[model samples]
Target chain A: MKRNLAQVVLSTVALLIVLSAFLPDTDGGFSGIVKSADSYFPIWFSIIAVFAFVLGASSLIGSHVRKIKDRETDWQYSVVTVLSFAIVLIVGLAKLGGASGLEGDVSDPASVLGRIFSSVLSPLHATLFSLLAFYMASAAFRSFRIRSLETTVLLVSASIIIIGRLPFASKLFSFLPDALQWLRPDKLSLWMLLVPNTAGQRAVLITVSLGVIAVALKYILGMSRDMFGGQK
Target chain B: MSSDSLLLLITLVVIAAAMLRHRDRKSEVDCIPEIEVAVRKAAELNRPAYFIPGSRDIDNIQTISALSMLKVVARYCAEYDVELIIPVSKSMVMERAREVCNAAYEEAGFSDRWSSSQVSYTTDDPLGFVAHVDGMIARAKPAVCFMFGFFAGESLLLAESSYNVAEVTIAGTAVPSQIPFFVASCDTTLIGEEFFAASAMLSGNQEDIAMLQGLDAGKQLAIGIILAVVVLSYLTLIFKPEMYESFLTIVDNLLHGGGR
Candidate 1:
């Protein structure tokens, strides 16, 4: 009975939200009521989200603590995690450094929280982000292998696009004859991106949009029970 | 009504009709072979399987789709007695994931095997979360990794890291920019709409299949309209040049809800 009630509430809210998007906005009438409700819904969502952040923070701490307690593999990392989390939380809450008070900004440049974010977290973020370049290079090497006709086509197209985007692509092919000038890397790359690439992208977008609509409809109609932990 | 609203209404009507038609009919869904293979491989290797539900929070549709797929993946893991690890960026996702996984385990009669630790909350910072996951993947060396959700620049990073350690890496995302990265790095990739369709296809539920059919029908309708407009525009430009401007105006108004 509780599940039924929850489903009913969810479905009604979902349906109303969908309907509200289609309804016109006016100063008075049914559309006005919907417009008002739609406006307030986001504020409610933000309130709930604030509470969710607390849940997430607790979950993070709990998981790390459990790992430390159980002596799980790489438990040493959990110690670092907990220590960093505590330091950051305390420093931010106490508003340490630079205009220290309740009115002070936690992220003020001179604040300890600000220093941690800039000095420690920033570098760590940059290090992880920098690894992407190397990973992309390795991934590209593997993907460019000519194992089949499809891969061969991919290899050729990728090479053209890469070379075409170079600053001197047109000049690199300037020695070619007039007729062959059309084969300039820059021109070819532009055609590849603007024509075939755009067409393929549009097709994917359209299909994906339809799929999204289907999924949203399924939820609004209460057909997707799996998401709510019910059997399909 | 606006053009956007009209299109949505049409889609809703078509889906409703399809649902009614397939209400009593049982339909077959061609399941992705990688899902079972990945779970079985983990079981055989006695290693955990990692499922990343994406970097986005729970509000995104892609994340919701990813969670739906998680239920199925968790069930398989439970049945095979393999540990399923899920690292989430959002707290709500963590909560929802725990619930879905527990329910899946219960349904599989392995309720005792379920644990909240399986669904951990990493940082909400995108790169920070990626760093955490990368370290986890490197350390645990899971047999198989499944990444399904919304992703940005970190897509290739995660896929490549998984590819190095795992025997098989399967990924899916609706993000167009990230699709090429998954295609290049993962053993199996579900592109665009396929990711959204996966859970329903895996379930093989009659209503789900009906919804998919409705989606396909809507696509056909969209294609027909596009083709008609293209042909009509060309005809007007060639045979009735003076009316071409008016034709474009009409098309724009019809498509964009202009002149409101």
Candidate 2:
């Protein structure tokens, strides 16, 4: 009984959203409802997300507590995790430090939370994100191995692009004949990026957008509700 | 209905009809072999299968796609009794994920075995999620990892880390920019539309595959129309230059809100 009710509500809400997407916006009463739903649902999602944030914090804390209690291997890591979570939560919630006296946007540079974000979170994110270059290089090593024509082309394109984008490439190619200098790394990279690369990206984007549309259709029709724990 | 919505509705109807008409036929999805192999390997190794539904929230299309893909993963894992580790970046996804996993298990007559611990809400931060998954890969050492949904720069970061741990890695996403990274790092990479096709085929429902086939037909038609327009546009530029201007204007108008 509970399952059936859940399915009904799920399908009904989904169908409404789908219908609302197609509804024309006007001053009429029906359009008003659609517009309101379109406006209001995201607000509800935000509210739910805020509550879910609390739920997630609790889960993380619980896991760390379990680890600390059980004296799990390298449990000190758990202590740090829990401490960091607590500190950030408290500092942000209480608006401790920086711009605490401000009427709005208390997370100004003066607040401890704001400073931590700038000093700690920002750096950590940047450091972890910087791992992309290393990962890219590693991936390139495998991808650029000239086992086939495709890899050879890829390697050449990548090398040209890399060299072209570098600060020294223009100077490096300055010795070339003025006419032939157009084949310099920068020009070649620009042409490649503007023409072939842009075209390829556009194709991918279109294909992916169409795929998303089909998926959205399935979702709207409720044919894919098995994922929602509804009938298969 | 809006014009775009009407077109979509028509496409769905066409796809549904095709699905019903061709229910007996098999649709070729290249990822079938790898998905089957990965599922089997995870089951055999008695290791968990991890499904990361990208870093995006539920508002993103890729997350919705990823969640649908997870239903298949959940069902397969439940049947084999191999643990499925669903590490979601968003808590909302975790909530829905629990319901999905429960349903999958219950459908498999394993209602008593439904557990939400296998599915976790790790963190909302993108890189933080990556860091957590990296740790999970090193420690838990899941046999196979399915990275699906929308990904950005973190795609390679997670994939490379998973490469060091997992036996097989299958990644599917709508993000074209991330496809090259996945292709280089993962064993099997489903690029763009292939991801959607794979998701459809995973249902093992002929109707679903047929619907995908129908969409493929529509896609081909769109391509044909685009090609025809391109050829005609160039021809007009060479042979009928005056007509070319008007043609481009018509095309521009249609593209902008005129057609709608």
Candidate 3:
């Protein structure tokens, strides 16, 4: 009985949103009424999302607290977690770093929170994100193995891309034949990306888009709800 | 949408439903079994199983699909007494993840063993969430890792790091851009539509399986429709240029939000 009610609610909301897509907005009347269903619902969804942020924060807090109580390995990190949360919460709420003391925006560049974020958080974020390059290089080493025919093709394609896309490649590889002048690394690489890569991605995109529609239909009809941890 | 696109959608949906009711199709996706193996491995080792739903909020359907897979993993973990850790980007998803795991455990008669803390929200920032999960990967050293959903930016970095740490890492995403990275780094990778298939296949429910078949039917119908449209459109343009021009204008208005 409960599950059936849930299904009815789910289907109704989904159908309403889907209908709103076809309804055009017009000045005051049924169109306005229909269009607002599409427009206003997102605001409500966003509000729910904002509330969920609290639930997420509390879950993080509870887990960290358990880590502290259990003295789990790396429990000390939990202290850092708790402290950071408290500091960020207090500083932002009180606007401690604001130029106008508590009166100014917490995000004002001159404010303490802003300066701390600028000086500390931003660089830390940059450094971590930068590590991705090294990680990618490593993963590429494993991925670019020349064992199979497919891998060999991939290696050749990647090599052409790397050489072509790099600056000063034309200068370095300037000894090419006149007939092969169009084989400039950049031009060839661009052709490879624009042609094959785009074609392949587009093909997949077409397939995936259709799949999304079907999967969405299944969801709206409540056929796949059981997979989402709900009982039939 | 334009009339043609709407026609395509309706055609595909009808075809898919017909296929489901009539066809006996089966999934040939390689990663599906690999995911099963990973779950069983985690059970044997009694190590934690980490499921990263995505870096997106619950508003994203990929995140919801990830939850479906999480239910499968949670049930296996409950059955085998393996630890299941689900780290999501949104708090709302965290709530759903907890409910899924708790329900799975209850069904398995292991409700006492299920902890809501197992599903957590690390951070709202994409890379920040990646950093926390990376930390968990290093410290907990989970036996298996399941990376599934719509990933961007940090997908490769997480895949590489997970590849280095876990005994089995199976990654699936419908995003074409990320599929290559997953294929290269993970032990098993489900590319594009295969990730969608995983959702239906994991359940082993006949209706879900039928939907999977339906998706294929839709794809086939779309191909035929596109081919016929292209031929008819060009033939019209060649034989009746003025009519073709008018048709193009009509299509443009219908498709480009100008008709309103």
Q: Which regions of candidate 1 deviate over 4 angstroms?
A: A98-103, A175-180, B258-260
Residue-wise C-alpha lDDT for candidate 3, range B29-82, written one tens digit per residue: 333667777888988887898899988877777777778788778877888888
Fnat for every candidate: 0.77, 0.60, 0.70
User: How displaced is residue A146 in candidate 2, in Å?
Assistant: 2.4
lDDT of 1 by residue, B1-260 (tens): 78867867887787666656665677677888889988999999999999999998777889988988898899999999999999998888999999989888998999999998888887889898898999899999999999999999999989999999999899999988889999999999999999988877886777778777777777778888899999999999999999999999888887776654
Error of 2 at A223 (Å): 2.2
> What is the alpha-carbon lDDT for the whole of candidate 1?
0.87
Report the Cα lDDT for residue B103, model 2.
80
lDDT of 3 by residue, A9-121 (tens): 77887777776655555757766776777678789999999888887888788889989999998899999999898898887877875655546787888867898788988
Model 2 in CAPRI terms: which quality? Answer: medium
Best by TM-score: 1
TM-score quality measure for candidate 1: 0.94
Calculate DockQ per candidate and list them: 0.72, 0.54, 0.62
lDDT of 2 by residue, B1-260 (tens): 54456655655565545545655686565447777678889999999899998888887878877776887888778887788888888888888788878887887887665687777776788898999889878899999999999999889999999988999999998898899999899988889988888777776665566658666765775687579889989999999998998998776564443463
- Stretches of candidate 2 above 4 Å error? A1-33, A98-106, A166-185, B1-31, B43-46, B79-81, B108-114, B258-260
Any idea what lDDT model 2 has? 0.80
Compute each candidate's TM-score over C-alphas. Answer: 0.94, 0.86, 0.88
Position B231, candidate 1: lDDT:
100
User: What 10-residue stretch in candidate 1 chain B is worst by lDDT?
Assistant: B15-24
Residue pair clashes in candidate 1:
none
